[model samples]
Structure formats: C-alpha cells, structure tokens
Target: MTLPVEAGLHRSCCLIDTASLSHNISVLKKGLAPGAEIAAVVKSNAYGHGVRIAWRAFVEGGATWLCVDSLHEAQELRDDGYTGNLFVMGHIPPAHAKTAVSLDVRCMVYDRRQIDALGEAANAASRPLRLVMKLETGTQRQGLTIEAALNLAHYIARFPYLVLEGTATHFANIEDTTDHSFAYEQLRIFNEYNDILTANGFRPTLRTIANSAAGILWPHTHCELVRAGITCYGMWPSTECYVSARLLGKDVDLRPALTWKTLIAQIKTVPAGSLIGYGCTYETTHESRIAVLPVGYYDGYDRAMSNLAYVLIRGKRAPVRGRICMNMCMVDVTDIPDAEPGDDVVLLGRQGGESLSAEQLATWAGTINYELTTQIQTNIPRIAV
Candidate 1:
C-alpha cells in the first residue's frame, strides 16, 4: 500500500504505550498502602502524552483520583465520561468556583478570598464545596504562608459550608539530592501543621505532600496520598530521584511510553564544500549524502539543539548538520549507503536496532526531559499503540 501525505510539515507522530502506562501504575501501587488511592496528575495534557488517553489508561490501571490544573481540565474529563474523584491542583479563580462545585470538581484553596467565595457559592446552591488547602514552606510560588495556613485551617474548621477535604504541599526541588534536606524541611512543616490541625480539632480527610520524586524516594512523606506526574509516564522526575531509588534498593523498572517517528522529506548528495541550512552554520567538509527531515523548532525539537544533536535514520545515528530551522533539519548519512527517501527516522524513540531517549536529548539541550516533552507543539498528532 502507498503512503498518503498529510498537510503541513507532518513530521513526527508520537506513539504512546498504554501498556507501559499501566505497568508504571502498578509499580506505584506497590508503594501505596491498602485503600490508599493515587491521584494521577493529568495536568498539562498528562505531561504531553494527551490527557484523554492518559486518563483512560490511568483509570483502567487502578487510579481513582485524578488531578488537573483547572476546572476546564476536570470538565474535559467529565465530558469524556470519567466519573471519579477529580481535584484541581492549581488554584481555580473565584469566578470559576461555581463551575467547579457544579461539576463536582474539588478546588485547591490557596488564599482567603477563594475560601470565602467558595463558601458563599456552596451555601447559595445548598451544597457543601470541597477544597484542599495548600501550605507554603519554602517553594514560595503558591500556597499559604505558615501563619496564613494556620489561620485558614482554623477558620475553615468553623465554616460548615466549606469542607477541607485535603491538605497538600508542593516541593520546589524534590529531585535534587542537595535539596533533599530542603524537601525534608517542607515535610517537617507539613507535619507540624498536621499536628496543629489535630490539636485544634480540625482533621482533614487527606494529607499529602509527596510528588513523583518524593513518592519514589521518601516513602515516609507519603501521608495519605501522592501526586504522581512524570513517573506515571515512565520518565524519572529527576536524576537524583533515580539515583536515590537505586541506592535505596528499590527497583523502578520504568520504560518511556512515548516514541516519536518521522520520515525523510528529501535526500541528496551534496558536492564537497557546499554550505547547508540557514545562516550557513555548517559547510560540507567532503562530498556527502544528507537527509532532510521535516522537523524543527516549531515542532518543539528546539532551535537550541541546532548543530548539537543527532537523529536515528535507517538504524544508524547521524549527526545533525548546520542549524535546525523552524520546519526542517539535515543529518549527514553518507556512511549509510542505502539511506533513501521515505525512510523512517526516529527523533525520540527506538529506531531499528538503536534508540534515543528524551533524557539524552534534554542533556544536549541543557534542559530537562519534562521541558522537552511538554514543549512538543500542539500541531503534531499523537497516537496510542
């Protein structure tokens, strides 16, 4: 059968492994206690694996709690027939609190104004609204300060219309060993707050502070639930997390669930001393064969990776020559005698007998895998296989 060309660049399509996702869920399950449910953090489109697909696989893999960034994300899941516990991890503005309550979505309460609004909305509708209070220890991005958190907890305890269903803290550096002590400090503050709540006769149904890295490396901190994001996709939250897990004698046999594949847009043999790509960043040192790949910065491969990366073509790794343009890049393939047009190219996955990981690509970009995967443009199609 002949292949049909799609519109635009149509470079790489990502293949996601629903099975690996299930496997990772199983691995995380081993860390939880009986009846402890995991909240699959599907925020940011399941960290770029596509939200709907990840949500389906997550539910099927035994996750009952789903966490998202906004009411719209929770509504998207609801629209798709997901009937389970849904919590908005990020703050939902007071304007959106009614929608969250009406949709049966829990909101994250980070400030006093949100709580007051939620209480008023819930009371007017004859419904009790659920919210999780976020405590800020050191991250200093969101969440209430120590004194504010204490006051909020006490005030919420007296508010009958507003139910504090959970309390959570997000760590700024859960993946760095040097920052491990900082993470511990956050946990200590969380524990102290928990103690204060208990003493004040304010008991929340759930208390959680562990993210993917903390859940994997610091089990003692997994109070009642854990918010897992990157690890669910088989990507390590950070190098320190993986190293710490290894040192702790825990086996997190994770396989990356996303694979990106494209095809040769064109192939040609250029004469010696020929200049290549925009700004002529690279020149042909010798008569060489090159393959044009229809993938570039616009697709989220990153212009920073220009002239510093490689792509897998015909089971061989070829150095990307010159600069990576918005729509294409070139790889020298002179040594691969049979390389040709329409041949499959691997940008971030297994190709024939070799493989390339986003981790390695992130290193080349001087960034992280999370950034690389999340930066993938919305234009590309993602398929689950």
Candidate 2:
C-alpha cells in the first residue's frame, strides 16, 4: 500500500535487535559442552529477519558456522562478506555443484548422482567440496537409509576431491510433543547408522542431529555441532519445546529480536450502523474512529487475522475490523484517542507496555510462530535496532 512520505517512513518495517540476538546465542552456548559448535541456521532470509543483518549479528555473537537452505543463500552470505563456515543444509541441485565448489560452500548429499556431480566439480576446480551425509532416521525426507549411507560413505572414500566432513539427520517430531519417545527412537536409529558408517571406515569429523528443539531439550544430541534455527532468532520452536526445556531444567531466556511496525494511513470517523471493510463482516454499533493500516495479507499479515487480531497504537490495543484487504486493513481505534494518520502502529511488536507477539498472531491466524515470522514479505525493509 502506498502512503504519504511521512506515513511511508513508518508504514512497514522490521527492527532487528542485535543485543537480543547475541543474548540468544549466549543462551544456546551455555547448554553446549566444550568442543561442540553452533551453526546458526540463517535460511529464508534469516527467517524473514534479513539475512545480511541477522547473519552478521550471529557471526559477531560467535556463531561457529552458518547453515542455509540453498546454494543461492550461501552465495548471498559470501557476497555480503560472511567468511565463516557456510553450509547448505537443504538440497543443492547437481547442476549447481560447480558453483558450490567454486564458492567453497559445504552441501548435504543424499543421492549418488549429487555426490558424483559434486565430486566431478570439486575435481575440476581442484578444491575439495565438503559434504554432509543426511541419514534417514524416520524423517522420510531427504536422507539415505543405513545401508545406503554406508554405501555412499564407501563410495565417497574413493573420491579424493570430495570430503565427507559430517553426518546429520532431521528430527520429525522433536518439537511437537513433550513425550520425545519418537525423537529418541530417531536418535537411536541415527546412532546405529553412524555406527555402521564408522564400522565401514567412514568416520565423519562432525556429527550433528539436533535442530532447535533437540539442541535445547536434549543436550546429548548436540554431538559436534548444533544447528540452531528458530531459537537463535529468539523464538521457541513450539510450546512443547519450551515445556521440554523447563522440564529438563534448561530454562533459556530468549528475547524476541524482531519488531514489525507500520503507520496509520488514514483516520476517519464512521457513523453507527456503518459496515466496515470487505464482505460487510463488521458493523459498527456506535460511532467509531478507525485507523487504516498500509499492510495486509500481502505483507504476510494473515487474512485470517482480519477479525480476530489486534494492533497496538498509542500504547493501546486496536482490534482489527472486518476483512483484511490485499494491501490494507482497518483497526478500530476508537479507544485510542491519540491515534491518527501517520501515528506509529505496531503490527508485531511492543508499543509502550502492550505488545503483539508472533505467537499471539500465529494463534489468531491459526498457524505457528515460525510460519508467521517466516512468511513476512522479504521486500519490506528491515532495520537494525
């Protein structure tokens, strides 16, 4: 939504608190044993917090490595001057092996074709491409079976140009339930796979099987490196993750580092019995003052939050009225006397003592905080606080 210059300045922006980011890193580090490293997962533009800014915060906070979803993301980090250990945790197409090897980015390998391509690329470039083999431990996603993993390790040993530097796995339900029986089972299977690999003379230097939830709740799973994703961004993976942490006596003090703000595009008075916004879903029973916001579903402000959510203006809660439009929505600011056009509007952050958290918005939108924060349109300017 377009706005006047004054309103545009505040219409939409995300503020990243570097101090809070560092605090989270410290919290995660406290749980790790000596020699265990933290690989900050900075994929999806640092979960929509701006990769360039957040990755720097992570590096300055002493992150040992950076994990991203794609080769492009790794290139972005390199282009932005991040010279730390960068690994692509997600799939890298066989075609991008040359670029990946040239850029010195580690990649996860699951298929023989990928390994062959990467080995060829590394041979051609005269540079060893580090690889992490993902073990299939019930996730059923991108991973190799125990037998396949062992075979791949044997196959990789023949390639002098390809180095199997690590072995990893993804937990399917570690964050969903407090009863981590399934996760423990997955870990057991992962260990069995590792044992087989080691038995076959394929001992990887680094072994990681913990995501944010496992890293926080199960310290034993933090083998050589822990990949901290949502938690590093000051967000809990799930309610169960928080509970599991407390139950395990690993109470971490995580402060959210992002604050999304907008501005009131227009302020108008609506008479009683007037319909508001799309679908005529909301009817004003009394004379009300409404503040228009230059943000909606298009900006990752879920359309489902149209009638269920509220924004903060002038330190007061302003309930959203009616259906949310593509680029705008209206909040009932009748109780907020000082709210007017160009007034600061908090979409997902604190305003004075009132705050709108990602978790709260996730509830209102019938989703999770990860989806809420990660879905924020990347085009919106992110400023460091």
Compute each candidate's TM-score over C-alphas: 0.94, 0.97
- lDDT, candidate 1, 225-286, per-residue tens: 88888988889988888888888888887778888777888889999999899989999989
Q: Candidate 2 lDDT, tens digit per residue, 223-267?
A: 999999999999999998898888888778998999898888899
Q: Pick the candidate with the highest TM-score.
A: 2
**Alpha-carbon error at 275 in model 1, in Å?**
2.0
C-alpha lDDT score of every prediction, in listed order: 0.82, 0.89
Residue pairs in clash, model 2: none
For model 1, the superposed segments whose C-alpha errors exceed 4 Å read: 1-9, 157-159
lDDT of 1 at 308: 87
Clashes of 1: 0
TM-score between candidate 1 and the true structure = 0.94
Q: Which portions of model 2 show Cα errors greater than 4 Å? A: 1-10
Q: For candidate 2, what is the TM-score?
A: 0.97
- Candidate of highest lDDT: 2
